[model samples]
Target chain A: MKKFLSLHSLLSLICLLLVANNIKYLFVFIMSRQKVLNEVYYEPGYQFHTFLPHLKGVEKAGYITDLSVNRESNDGAYLQAQYYLAPTILELEDINYPYFIIDSKNTDFIIRTIKETKARRLANNEYGQALMKRPAP
Target chain B: MITIGYFLSFLLGRLTLDRCLKENVRLLHPCAAALLALVSGLGLSALLTFLTFVVLDSFHRPVIILVNISAIIIFLFFNRNLYIQKTIIPITDWLPWTKFRWFHFLYILLGVFIVGVAYVIALTHPYGEWDAWAIWNLKTRFLIVSDSWNLIFTDLHYHTHPDYPLLLPFINTWIYCFSADNLHPIPMVTNIIFVIGCGGFLCCTLYQIRKFSFPFLMGLIMFTTPSYLYLGTFQYADSLIAFFLLINLYFITMFQKTKDASWLNILGLSLGLTAFVKNEGLLMALILMFVVSVYILIDKNNRVGKSAVKHLLFTFLITFIPVLIFKVFIAPPNDDILPNINTSNFTAERFQILYNAVITEIFHEKWCYMWIVVLALLISRIWRAFNRENIILSIFFIIYSSAIVCIYVLNGKADLSWWLETSLSRILFSLLPALVFFGVHLHYSKQRGAHV
Candidate 1:
C-alpha cells in the first residue's frame, strides 16, 4: 500500500534526516497552534528571488548552502566575488562583479577543501560563480 | 569512489558510442569507439565528484533527502537484476565508433556549425536570460578548481535553485584541465557541445523512429526552437539535462520491449546523469522509474523482482548521500523559503489563502491555453493506443508529459504566471521534442506529408 512513497521517500527521509541533522527546508512550517519542542531553521528571512526568471542562471538562489575549493598553485589560487548590498543570497549575481573579490580566510581551509566546489557554484556554470577556490596560474 | 564514477561514466559513454556506431556502422572506425568510450567514461565519473557542492550548495543534503529516497523507491518498484556487464543492446549499444561514412562527418559538422554560430553571438551579446550568466556558466568558472565549498553561501543566499544534476561543468573541466588553463568562455564551448549533441541525437532518434524526413523536420524544429537555442548558447543546465533526457528516453524505449539488462544500466546511468544535471530532474526521473517499475512488476516471469532491492539501495545511497551530507550536516539551513513555511509576515492562514488564490487565479488563468491544448492532444493519442505507434506515442504522451506537469505542479515555484509565460513552456519544452517526435512518427504511418 505504501508503494515506498515514490522517489521522494528518500527526500522525506532526508527531510526527516534534515531535522535530525539540524538542517532546514523552506517547506517546514507550523502544522498547528502547538509549537514543536525543537525545529531546524529554514531561514525565514529569504524571499522568493524576484530576478530568478530574468537571471536565468539557476532554479533558485540560496538553494545551495556551502562551498569549498582548492587549487594546487598560488597564482591560480585567487578568487573573484561580488557580494550584494542587502545580502539575501539571491542578489549575488546583481552585485558589481569584476567589482569584488573573496577568498577563504585560511590557506589550511583552502588545502583541506582542495577541488571541492559548492554545489550551487557547480550548477551555475563557470563564470557565474562569485566565490571561488583556485590554483596558481 | 572516483574510479568507480569514472568506470561507470566511461561504460555509459561506451554504450552511447556503440549505439551511435551501430546507427552508422559504415562511418565508424573501431578506434573511434575507444575514443568515445574514453571521453564518455572519464567525462561522467569526473562529473560526479566535480558535482560535490560545486554546483549546488546543499548538494549532499538535498540529494540524500530528495534524490536517494526517490531512487530507492524506483529500485524497489522496478526490482529486477542481472549482470549488467554481460549484456548489451546491439542497436543501442555495441557500436563501432572507428568506422563511419563521410555523411556522418558532414552531419556532425552541420551540428557544430549551428551551435558554433549561436555561441559566437552569445560571446558578444552577453544577452542572456540573467540565470545563464548569473547562475550556471558563471558559477561553473568559480567552481572549476574551487577549494572552499562555504563561499557559495556568502554570495547566493536564497534567490535561485542551483542544484541541477548535469555533468556539463565537469565536461568543461575536462577540457580546461586538458588545456591546463582557465579561460573565459571555456565553459561556453562545453555548453555548445551540449546543445549540438541534443540536436544531433534528436535527429538520430527521429531517423530511427520514422526515417530521414521526420528526423529532418525534428532537427529543424529543435534548431529553431526559440528559448532553447539561446538557453543553449550560454552555460545553463537545461541543454545538458535535455541531452540526458534524450538518451534516457531512448534507452527506456529500447529496454522496455527487449528486456535488455544494459538498458536498465542505461536507465540507472541516465537517471544519475539527470539528477546530476538538475534537481528537478530527480523528480521527473523518479516518476518515470515508478512507471517502469509498474511495468516490470507485471512482467510474466517476475524477472525483475529479485534484484530490484539491491539496486534500489545502491542507487539511493549513491545518489542521496552527497546531497544529505551537504544540506543537513555540514552547512544546515541558513536561508531560503519553503512552500509550506510561513515566511510571509502574514499569519499561517495566509498560506492557504495564498495557495488557494494561486491555484485559482494564476494556475487556472486563461492565457495559458497552450499547455492545455498540448495536454489534450497528448491524451487523445493515449486514448487511441491500439497499434505499435499508438502504444509508443501513448507512453511518451501520458507518462513523460504528465511527469513534468506533475512535478511543476508539486514543486510550484513563485510567480506562477511568469513561470507559465517564460519557464513552464521550457519545462514543457523538454518533453515537447520527444512528444513531437513521437507524434510525427505516428502521424506519418497513416498520412502523406513529409515532416522533415
Candidate 2:
C-alpha cells in the first residue's frame, strides 16, 4: 500500500481526477460538433479571396456588413477588418443599409436570411459579398 | 517531399550534434527520437521560412519550397562529418508486448482513451477556438493566397494581429501547399501535430531519464492541464511556444547533467524557435541569455567559463538572427501595448490591483492546477531547489515571471483588468511545461538522492 502513494501514483491520482472532468469537455464538443444548421448555394462570381488587394469594393458596398459565420456567431474580425483594412467611404445615410460578406462555407440560415431580405447577391464562389435591399427599420 | 526534408534535416542535425544522441544513437529509443524529430522538423521549417522571406521579397510557394529543400541539403553537407551507421533502438524498446504487466495495460488503455477524447475535442471545433481562425489560420489564408504575404504586414485591421510572428502561418502555408491547397483540415491537423509533439516530448524525455511509469504520469499531468490541452487543440501559438520552451529546458538540463556542449546547440535552436513562435518568446529568449551568461560567469573554472560564455553567445547569435530580421524588416508595430505611459499612474493601488488579479488567477483552483502543482513542488523542495545547478533555472523562472508582470503593468492596453483576466492564464500556460519540468526534477532528485 505504501507503494501506491509513490510520486507517480499520487500524480496519476490527480490526473484521474482531471480526466474525470473530460466528460464535461466531451459533452461540449459533442453538442457543438455540427456547426452548419442550414444549406445554401454560392451567389456566383465568388472566386476565392486570393488577397484583399484593395478595399475599394468593400468601401463602395457600405459599412457595417455582417461577416463570416461559424454556427451561431458572427465573425468578429469582419467589423475590425472593415474599419482598419477597408474603411467605407459611402454616404452616411447608406451606413444603415444591411449587407453581408459571407464565408464560402455559408449556412442555410445566412443564405435564407439574405433571400428573405431580397438582398442583391453580388459575388458568391468561395468568399461571398451581398447587399441587402432593405435596411432594418 | 519538401516537408519530409525538413524532418530529415533536423534528425541529421540532432544525431550529428547532440552528444546524448551521438553517444547513444544505437541505444536511443524510438519514441524519444520521434518527439525530437517533430520539434526539430517544425523548428527548421520556421527557420527556413523566415530565412527565405528575408532573402527574397516574394512569397511564392515554389520559391519557398526550393529554399527549404536547399537549406536541408546545405545543413546535411555542413554536418556530413558527424554522420555514422548507428542503428536506432527498435520499436520493441517503446512497445515491449512480451512483458504483460497489469499497470502497463492500464497505462496503455488510459493513453488511448485520452487521445481519443482529445481528438474528438479537436474535431468538435473544426476551425479551432477563436484565435486559431481569427489569428493563426487567418494568417495562413493570407500566406497561401497568391500575392497576400504583403497583406500580412499591411495596415489592415490589426485584428489579424499583424505584428505577431509568422512561424505558424508559414508552416500552415507549407502544409496547405503540400496538401494542394486543401485548406479545411490542414490547420486543424497541424495543431494536432503540435499537441502530439508537446505531449510526446514531455513523456519521452522524462522516460529516458526516469523510466516509464512516472514519466507517463507526468505526460498525463501535462496533457490533463486544461489550458494546455484546450489551447493545443485550439491552434494557439501558446501551445507551440510551450513545446519549444520545454524542449529548450530539456536540452539545458541535459547539458547540466552531461556537461555536453553539443546540448547547447539544441538549447539554442529550441530557444530561438521559441522566439519565432511568439512575441513573449522573444522576452523568454532574452531572459535565458542573460541568465545563462550569468551562470557561465559565476563558475569557478575561469578558462572553461570564458569559453562556455563565448560558445553560448555564438549559439544565441546564430539562432536569433532570423528572429532579428523578422522583427526589424517585417512585422508591423505592436498595437497591444499602450502608446505612452504615465509615470505617475504607477501607484500602489495599481500595483495591488494588478498583483492581486495575477495571483488570484494563477493560484485559483479552477483550470490552473499546473501552477498549484508547481507551487506545491517548490514548497516541498525549497531546500533542495537552492542548489548550484538549480540556481540558474530558478533565476530564469523568477526573472521571466517578473518580466511578464512588468509587461502587464507598464504596457497594458486601456482595458487593463480585462486583458489581465483573459490573457494572463493563457500566457502563463505557455510556461506550464517548465513548471512541470521543475516538479519532475524535484521528484527525481528525491527519489534518486541526487541533484537534478
Candidate 3:
C-alpha cells in the first residue's frame, strides 16, 4: 500500500491524466495541419502575398479595413497583411500615404474609401483586397 | 545555408562554453554542456550579428558571417588545449542506459510523442500566431528589407512595439543573412530548437543534480503542459525567455551547491542574455541579480564572498552591453508604460481584478491542472518550499509577479481586461517551467534531506 501511494505513483497518475487531457490537441493538430499548411487557415492574409511585387520599393502605405482593430479577427488580418507586404509600412485608417491597402469584405466600403481618399486603385487581388495610390497634395 | 548558420551557432556556443567553464568541463554532464552551448552560442551569434549591423550601419551578410567566424576562431584558439585534453565527449556516453527501468522507457516514449506534437503544431502554423507575424517576424522583415535597422523604431511603426528588445528579430535576421529571401521556416525551426533546448536542459540538469525519477517527471510535465507547447510553437519570445530563465535558475542552483565562482559568472552571463529576450526578461534579470547579490552578501553560512558578486555583475554587464546600446541609443521610448504611469491608477479595485485574473489563470484548463498539482505539493509541505536554495527562486517569483501586477495596475493606456486576456496567459506560461523546476527541487530536497 505504501508503495502504491508513493510520490512517484502520484506523479505518474498526474502525468497520465495530463497526457489523456491533452491528447485532443494532437488530434486537433492532425485535423488542422493540412488546412494550415495549404494556407487555407490563413487565406485572408495568404491572398495578399501576390501584392508583394506591386509593393516593392514602396516605403509606406495606408491600410483600410471594415472590421475595427479592437476585434481579434481584424487585428490578425491587418498584421498578417503587414507581414506579407513588409518593407512597405501599413498605416491603419490613414490614407495620406502614396499607397494604401484595402482589406475588407465589404465591397462598397472599399470603393467608398478609395473614392473619398482620392486614391486610384493600383492593384487588387480580386478577393476584396487592393492597393491604391493617393494623389499627391 | 540555414543549416550552415545553425552549425556555426552550435560551434560558437560549444567552444565558448568550453572556454568559460574550462576548469569545470569534466564536472558538467556532457548533455547539459551541449544544451548550454547551443543556447549561449545562439545568443552570442545574435549579439555579434547585432554588433555587425551597428558597425556597418546596415545588414551585410558577409560581414555578419565574418564576425561569427571570427568569434568561433577566437574561442577555438582559446579552447585548443582543452580539446587536445579530450575533455568533451559524446552525449550518448554520459548516461548508463543499460540500467534503465520500464518507467524510464515510458517517460522516453512520452517525451518523444510530446516533441512530435510540438513540431507538428509548429509546422501547422508555419507563419506562427498573430504576434509572431505582427511583431517579431514583422520586425525581422523590416530589418531585412530596409537599408537602416532604425526603420522598426520609426514613429510610424510604434504599434509594432518599437521599444521592445530585438533579440528574437535579430536571431531571425542572422538566419536570413544566409538566404536570399525571408523564409518562414527559419523562425519556426528556431522556436522548435528553443523548445527542445528548454526541455532538454531541464531534464539534464535534474539528472545531474539528483539521479532519479524527478527529472523525467519534471520534463514530462513541462512538455505535456498544453499551453507551453502552444506558446512555444507560436514562435513568441516567451519561449526564449523561459529557456533563459531556466538556464539562470540552473546556474544559481549549481552555484549554491558547488560555490564555484565560475558558476556565478555563467549565471551572470545567462542573466545578461535574459535581458535581451524581452522587456519582461529585463525586469526578471534585474530582480534575479538583486536577489542573488543579496544572498551572496548576507548568507553567512555559504561564504560565497564579495568577489563572487563582482564576477557575476561584470560578466552580466559585459554580455549586457549590446542590450544597453540597443535600449539607450536605438530603441525609442516605451509609450505603453512610461507615459501612462500615474499613481492614481493604483486602486483597490485594480488589485482585486489582478487577483481574480491570476487565480482564474492558475486553474485554467489550458494548463491541464499542472499548476493545481504544483500548488497542492507546495501547500502540503509549505515549510520545505523555502529552503536556502528555493528561497532565491521563491523571492524572485514573488517580486517578479508583484512587478507585473504593478505594471498592469499603473498603466492606464491599455484596457485592463483586454490586456490581461491577451497577455496574462503567456506571462504565466513563461513562469510555468521555472515553477515546475522549483517544485521538483523542493520535493527532492525534502526527500533527500535538503542536500539539493
lDDT of 1 by residue, B81-125 (tens): 211333432433345354467677876676565565555444533
Can you give the lDDT of residue B382 in candidate 2? 73
Off by over 4 Å in 2: A1-137, B1-21, B24-29, B77-112, B146-148, B212-216, B301-305, B359-370, B446-452
Per-residue CA lDDT of candidate 2, range B45-68, in tens? 667765666666546667766766
Cα lDDT, all candidates: 0.43, 0.61, 0.78
Using DockQ as the measure, which candidate wins?
3
Q: Tens digits of per-residue lDDT for model 1 on A1-137? A: 36466633533353333223221111121122114323332211112222223334332232211233212111211111211111223332222221222233455543444334321122122322233313322
Models ranked on TM-score: 3, 2, 1
Candidate 3 at A75: error in angstroms?
A: 3.1
Q: Docking category for candidate 3?
A: acceptable
- Chain B TM-score, structure 1: 0.64
Rank the candidate models, highest lDDT first: 3, 2, 1
Q: Please provide, for model 3 over A1-137, each residue's C-alpha lDDT reduced to its tens digit, 9 standing for 90 to 100.
A: 99779977776676656656667665664685666666644522677877788789888878877887763334566777877777777888877788888878886887788678888877778667788878888
> What fnat does each of the candidate structures reach?
0.07, 0.11, 0.51
What TM-score does chain B get in every candidate? 0.64, 0.86, 0.92
Candidate order by DockQ, decreasing, is: 3, 2, 1
Per-residue CA lDDT of model 3 for B163-184, tens digit only, reads 9998888888888877775467
Model 1 residue runs over 4 Å out of place are A1-137, B1-12, B15-43, B51-109, B124-128, B153-155, B160-171, B179-183, B224-227, B301-380, B384-413, B440-452
